[model samples]
Target chain A: MAGMRLQIIGCHSATPRLLARPSAQVLEIGNSPVLIDCGEGTQMELRRLRLKFTRIEHIFISHLHGDHFFGLPGLISTFRLLGRERPLHIYGPKGIKEAITLLLKLGESWINYPLHFHELEQGTSDTLLEAKGFTVKTFPLKHRVPTQGFLFRELPGLRKLKPEVAESHGISRAYYLKIKQGADAIAADGRTIPNAVLTEPPAATGSYAYCSDTAFDPELPGHIRGVHTLYHEATFLHTEAALAAKTGHSTALEAGKIARAAEVNRLILGHFSSRYNSLDSFRKEAQQEFLNTELAADGKVFDWAEL
Target chain B: MAGMRLQIIGCHSATPRLLARPSAQVLEIGNSPVLIDCGEGTQMELRRLRLKFTRIEHIFISHLHGDHFFGLPGLISTFRLLGRERPLHIYGPKGIKEAITLLLKLGESWINYPLHFHELEQGTSDTLLEAKGFTVKTFPLKHRVPTQGFLFRELPGLRKLKPEVAESHGISRAYYLKIKQGADAIAADGRTIPNAVLTEPPAATGSYAYCSDTAFDPELPGHIRGVHTLYHEATFLHTEAALAAKTGHSTALEAGKIARAAEVNRLILGHFSSRYNSLDSFRKEAQQEFLNTELAADGKVFDWAEL
Candidate 1:
C-alpha cells in the first residue's frame, strides 16, 4: 500500500496565539502532496516543517476567513521569489480569486508562476482534483461563511502476487502485470488461469475526510461514511455548546458524535479554541463518544502506514 | 534619556526562513511604543516577545511590499478578537488603506477599534505624528517603489532642578516650576535669580532613524544627519554590490559609508539578505567605516540607556 500521511501545520480556531496557530494541514496520499488550508503564518509553519515547497502543487482552502486564506498572497509571492516556475492550483470558494488578485495588484507585484484557481460552489458537492491515484471531492459545510470540507479517497492498490500459485500454474512473468490488474492470464500453452487464483486481493482503499469550521450537522455522516480517517473541528468544549452553535462551530462532543456516526476508523479532532489551555480535555471529551480519538497538535503527523 | 529601546522582530530580507524572519521592529521611545514596518508573521513575534499590544497605538509602514504589510489585516483582526477598543493609527503609503480595506471586506469582518490611516506622499517629507515629547517624520527613501523612511526625534525634556543651587540662591519652593520652565525666578526679597543658576541642563534629546529596502544614495544623509541611532538595510556584502544596487538594497559597506557620512552616533544594520549566515561579517564590514555599528539580531533590543 502507498503511504498516506497527514501533517497538521496549524489547527487553532479564530486567531493564532503564541503556542496555537490557525487552521492548515498537509495531506500526502500515494506520494502526492496536497495542502488543505493556507492560514496566516502557514508559510512559516511549512518552512519549519522542512516540507518540499515544490511538491505542494495543489492548495485547498475551505473558506475566505482571514485565518483560512490570508497566507495565500504571501505564499504565492514567496514562490515567485524562490524562482518557482511550475503552475500552482488553488481550489477554494468563490471570491477567492478576486481577493488574492486585489492584494497582488495593490502591492504592485505579480507572481511569475501560473496560478490556476478552481472555485467551488457552496450548494453542491463536486470533485475538485484527481491525480496520482487519488481523488479529492468538496462537500458543503455549515458555517457562518461559505465553507466546504474535503474528502480524499485513494484508488485501489496493485494486487498482491501469489508467487507460489502463479508458478504452479506455469504462468510466465510477462503476464504478472495483467494478473495485478485483475485480468485472467493466458499461458503460452493456451491455458486460462483466473486472476483470483493467480494473485491475492488488493489492500483496502484508504480514505480521509476533513471537516473544519462547521457546525454540528447530522447530514455530514452520509457524505463521509466509513472514511478510514476523519479530521473534524472541535472548536469548543461541551460546556460551550451554545457558543459553538452560535458561531457555527462544533464542540468536542459533537465532533465525536459525528465521527462515531460516520463509523470512521480513527477520528482526529483539531481547530481548537484558544480559550482552552490544555488539549487533553479535547481528546478526553472526544473519546467519551468515539473510542478512537486523536488530538491534532501542531506539527503532528499521522502516518497511515504506521497505523 | 527617555529609555528608548529598539526591539528587532524580523530582519531578514525577502522571504522568511526557518530561523530568520522578514523585516519588522518595535521602537520604544520615551516609554511609548511605535511599530515600524510590520512584515508577515510579525504579530507572532510580538506575542512571542510578550509586548503590550495596547501600547502600540501608532504603526509606520515603509512600503507596500507583501512582507511589510501582509500582517496588518491579521493583526487588526486579532486585536478585535482580543476585545481591543482603542484607536489604532497606521501611517503608510497611498495605497495602504485600499489594500487593507479590501482584505477586511473580503473576509466579511470588521474591527471594533477605530483604525486611522495616515498615508504619506512619495515625494514629500513631513511630520506625521507629535506627542509625548516625541515627533515622527517621514522622508523619501530610494527604492524600486515609493518607499519612505521614518525618523523619531525627541523634544526637549523637562529641565533638571539643581537643589543645592536653588537653596544657595534662597529661591522659594513655589518658584521651582517657573525656574524649571527656563524662566527667571524673583526671590521674596525682590532679587532676580537667573534660571541657569537654579537649574542644570536636561538630558540630550534622543533620536532614531529607520531606513530599509533602500539603495545607497548620498542624499539620505542630509535628511538623517546627526541622528543618535540609524538602522539601515544591509541586504548584501560588498562583493555583491552590483546585485544590491540592482535590487534597490544597500550592502554592509554601503550602509557604513552612509552612517559615517550622516555622522550618526550609532548604526544598527538590518534587513539582511538570507544568503549570508554569519552576521558577524556584516558588523565587521560596517565597523570598518562606522565604528559604532551593530547588527540587528532577532529578539535583540537596543536600549539607549545602556548605550
Candidate 2:
C-alpha cells in the first residue's frame, strides 16, 4: 500500500507566541497534498518548512476561529501575486465566503485565479471531498461554536498480478487489468484462465482522523473506530479539567480516554494551551490511558507505515 | 531637543519572503510609541523585537492594501487575548471599520478593550490624531486605491529656565510659565527682567513624513517641504521606471528627486520590490540625486538626532 504522511505545521491554542503556534497541518496522501486549519501565520510557517504553496490544491478549515483560518486571505493574495493559475479549493464552515469576500473587497484586490469555497453546514456529518486516491469526511464536533472533525481514508489498492504465471499464460498487458479485477481471461480458443491463479489480494487500506478545539465526548469514538491514527486535541492537563470543560476543550487524559475507546493503532495529541510551560506532562498523562500516545510538535512528520 | 527613533519592522513590498517581510514600522517619538502600516505577521515581528505591545496606543495605517493594514485584526485579537485594557486607536482609510467588524463577527470574538477607528476622507489633508507629545496628520497620495501618507511632528518643547537667574529675579514657580512664554518677568516690586535673562529659547520641532505605495508626483514635494526626514517608497529601480509608473510605484531615482525638490534633510528609501536580489543598487541610484539617502532595512533604526 502507498504510505501517507502528515506534517504538523502548528498545533497550539489561542494566539501565536514565540514557541507555540496556532493549529495548522499538511496531509500528504499518495499524490494529493491537502492543507488543514491555516492560522494567522500559517503561510510563513509553510514557507519556512519549504513546502510548495502552489501544490496545496485543497484546504480544510475546522471552524471559524481566527486561529483556524485567519490566514486564508493572505495566502490567497500571495498565490495571486505568485501568478498561480490553478484553481484552489477551500472547505470551511459557513460565513467563510462572506468574510473573505469582505476583506478582498476592502483591499480592492481582485484574485487573478479561480478560488472555490465549499461551506459546510451545521449538524451534518457526511463525505466532504473525494479525490483520486483518498476521501475526506466531516463529523460533528462539540465546541463553543459550530465545529467539525475531518477523517482522511485511503481507497483500497489495486490487486497485484503474478508476473511469472501471467507470462506463462501468454496474457497481454491490456488483459492484465481485467484479470486483476477478478476476471478470468478467456483465450481465443475459448479456454478460461482462473482469476485466483493470476492475481494476488489487495493491500489493507489506511485511515487517519483529526479532532481539535472540541470537548471530550463519548460518541466520538464510534465515528473513528479502528482508525490507523488519530490526532485528538489535548488543550489542557487533567488538573485543569474543570476549566477545559467550561471552555469546551479536552484535557490530555480525556483525549487519551477517547483514543483508548476508539481502538486506534496510534494516538497523537495536539492543540496545547500556551499556559503549560512544558509538554512532557501531556505525553505522560495521555500515555497512562493509551500506551501508543505521542505529542505533536511543529514540523514533525508522521508516516502511516511507521504505525 | 528630544529625539525620535524609528524601528523598521518590515520594509519589503508585496508578499513576504524568506528573509524579507512586508511593510510595518514602529516609530518612537518622545514618550509615545506609534505603530505604522501593520502588514501580515507584524505582531510576530513586534514580539520578536521585544517591543511592549500594550504600550502601543496609536496605530497609523497609510492605505487599505493588505500589505499595509492586514495585520490589524490579528493584533487587536492578540491584545484582547493578552488582557490589555487600554483604549487602542486606529487611523486608516474608509471601510476599515467594516472590514474588521465582519471578520470579528464571523469569528464571534468579542473584544474586551475599547477600539476606536478614525476613517480618513478622500482628497482631504488634516490632523487625524493628537497625543501628549506628538501629532499625526494625513496627506493625499497617488495609488491604485484611495491612499494617504502620514506626517508625524513633535510638539514644541518647553523653554529651559535658568534656575539661578530666575531665583535672583524673585520669579516664583507660579510665574515661571509666564516667563517661559517669551514674556519679560515682572517682579513683585514692579522691576522688569528681560525674557532672555530668565529662560533659554526652545529647540526646533522635528517632523517625519511617510509616503508609501505611491507613484511619483510633483505635488508631493509641495506638501512635505522642509520636513526633517522623509521615508519614501522606492519600489523599483530606474531601469524599471516604466513598470513603476504602470503599477503606481516610484523608482529610487524618482524618490530621490522628490527629496531634493522638497528640500528635506534626509531620505530613507523603503517599500522595495522583492525582485531585486541586491539592495545596494537602490541606495546607489537614489544617492546620485540626494546625497544623504539610506535604504530601509528590517530592524534598521533611524535616529532623528543623527539627521
lDDT of 1 by residue, B1-307 (tens): 5568888998888887767888889988767899998888888889989988667899999998888888888888888888998899999999888878877776778877899999998968898988887999999999988899999988877689997877877778887887788988886677998887777777877889999889999999999999999999999999999999998999999999999999999999999887887889999998989999999988899877743
Among incorrect, acceptable, medium and high, the docking class of model 2 is: medium
- Per-residue alpha-carbon lDDT of candidate 2 for residues A142-175, written as tens digits (9 for 90 to 100): 9988888999998876788898887787777788
lDDT of 1 by residue, A1-307 (tens): 4478889999888778767888889998868888998888888889888988667889999988888888888898899889899899999988888878877786777888899999988857888877878999999899988899999998887899898888877888987887898999876577898887888888767889999889999999999999999999999999999999999999999999999999999999999988887889999999999989999988999977633
RMSD of 1: 1.8
What's the distance in Å from true for residue B194, model 1?
2.1
Instruction: Give the alpha carbon lDDT tens digit for every residue of B24-102 in model 2.
Output: 9999985778999998888888998898867999898988888887778889899999999999999889999998888
Chain A vs. true chain A, TM-score per model, equals 0.96, 0.95
Best by DockQ: 2
TM-score of each: 0.96, 0.97
